[model samples]
Target: MYPVIAGGALSAMTFPGQTAGLSVFADPLIEQLGIDRSTLSLSYLIGTLLGAAAQPAIGRLLDRFDARRIIVVIAVLFSGVLFALSFAQEIVGLTAGYVGVRMFGQGALGLAATTAVAQIVRRRRGLALGVSGAIGSAGISLAPVLLERVVSEVGIATAWRLEALAVLLVVVPIALTLPRPAPASMEVQRTSTGTIIVAGYTARQARRTGMFWVLTGALSTSAMLSTALGFHQIGLLGERGLTPLEAAANFIPQTITALAATLIVGALIDRHDPRIFVVGSMAAMAASMLLVGIVTPGILAVIYGLVLGLAGGALRGMEAAAFVRYYGLTHIGSIRGLAVSISLAASALGPYALAVGAEWAGNFSQPSAWLAIIPAGIAILAFMVPQPSPRATRPS
Candidate 1:
């Protein structure tokens, strides 16, 4: 429970550096810099792409050093980045700030928090991840709202400066309290599919397995679809004949369903095989896309929110647990880092892909229907993948 609480707190610390947090200042920044929307987005994308590309290295560092020490450094640096962002006067300044925020805040800080908890709790990892994810998610949800209020009162620059101060004064102190443990000393064993325990598979070895690719593919696809839809949700809802208020109201159902599903999935994965969650998440994603693509508004719309929310919540919980469950924690940081990079790259591509699809098909429904086929196929294939043995003997 302590590790879980720490993980959740660290996750919340990512708010100032995440996309939602940065978005609040977008309008004011653009207005001040005299740039168009496309230009600003392009700058942001470039920065994010570079940051994503560096995740594997960051993961290696986690494996090589004390996570608590690393997290403290990252938090302090992230604060500096926010400070830099507040004083940006040109495109280059914004780009540097974006890189700092994405690389340190989103990538390294987030990775440290989760990995710390995973290191601490071996048996009930599912529950720990579930609680941390839920708390982290709540932090993300509140970030934009909080930033908006601050921006309104103090203005964007001052708001950012305050955020920077909060990170240094609040986040770093909490980070210093995190536990530091020695790496696992368990013996290594090789299996038909992958290595098991202590000397866990390196990122290269992990990628060689069918299970690794499938799990990564499933997660990447989820990230792509979820991010794309979220980016255009209001517009999509309007196309379905919903007023602004109705569309906003749908978030209530989604949030409730997501919270409920997260806790349930968390508890279940600890007791049962994790593969069930993989299949369930795939099915929920497919159901969500199909529902939103075809169903009429009214009650069905709320149902769509529930299914979508479940998919998101469950998928996140499962993905976090799967790395340790299937691959072992010896080098979990490096292995998970590669997986996260792929997911982030997919997220970047999703909006563009969906936009192109909408333009070509003349409506979101057609593209959404097409997108639904991806998870459906993955769901069929997930069944064939076997559960990895927790510890296997080395071949002699």
Candidate 2:
């Protein structure tokens, strides 16, 4: 539980490096760097793509060493990047800064934290992740709002510096308290509750099964669809006659619903087949996207937001559970890293695709309707994925 709590805390630290946090800096960056939206957007896409490309390597490190060490190093480097971002004078500097933030914050830190928690517990893995996810989600959801206030009060540069200080002073100390993984002989030791140890497939062995690809497809589709809606949420809501304030106000309902879903789904995952949760969540996302496409009223929009929140929570939970449940913790980091990289790479295209679709169709509605099919398809694939044979293999 201590490791899980520490992991959750570390997960929250990534908020400073996530899209929501960085979105607050958009206006400041444009003003300071003199670059148009497209230029900055492209630079961000490139940097994020580069960051996604590094997850496999980072995952290998997690497999080789204590996740605590990897997490601490990433925390330090992520803070430095945030601080450096405060001084960017040009596009090159801005892009470089993004590479550090996205790589360390979203990719490596999350990988390390989840790996740490997963390593420590097997009998109650799902519940631990649920608690961690709930805490991390709340922190991440509030981060942009808090940072916005800070930026308004003290300006963007100081906000970045303050964020850096928070990581250095606050996060690093807590992260250092995380325990290392148990030794190999103790890895399969069981509790008095009679939970039997199941051997797991290695990353390479898991990839050979259709289940791997199906799970990846479902998870990545959820990431891409949700990210697209979130990126254009304001514009989409406006098209349905909601004011900026109304659109922004939906965040609280969304976050609360998501938090509830994370906790509920976490408990269920411990007892039921994960595919059930994954497929159900994807179906919810599909319905939500369809609702957004055909929006006409107040209750409908609220329902859409709530369902979208459920999808988001389920995606996070399943992504955390799938690799550990299928591939053993022996190389869980590497297996999950491969999946995370694919999802991250797919997420980069979400906004780009939606924007292009909107431009081609002249409104967000058509794109929203078209995007609905993606999750629906993935849900079908997720339904077909069989549980991988729990035969653990030595890392090659």
Best by lDDT: 2
* Model 2, span 1-396: residue lDDT tens: 777677788888888778878888887778878889878888888878888899988988988887777777887888899899888789998899888888888888888888888887666788889888888888889899899999989987799899988888866787678765675333553446554455656678878988788777876787788878888888888888888888877777779888998888887787788888878888888888888776654787788789989988886776677667766777778888888888877777888898899899988888888888988887887766667776633333
Candidate 2: C-alpha lDDT: 0.80
Q: lDDT scores for all predictions?
A: 0.78, 0.80
Q: Over the stretch 1-396, how does candidate 1's per-residue lDDT look in tens digits?
A: 777877888898798867667777878888989998767877877777777787888888888888888888888888888888888889998988888888887778888888888777766788888888888877776788788889989887798899889878866777787666646546344457776445566778787777887788888888888777766676677788878678756767777777777777877777787677888888998887777676556888788788888887887777777787777777888988888778776776776777788889888888988899988887877878765545444444
C-alpha displacement of 77 in model 2, angstroms?
1.0
For model 1 the local lDDT of residue 313 reads: 83
Top model by TM-score, which number? 2
TM-score result, candidate 1 = 0.91
lDDT: worst 10-residue window of model 2: 183-192
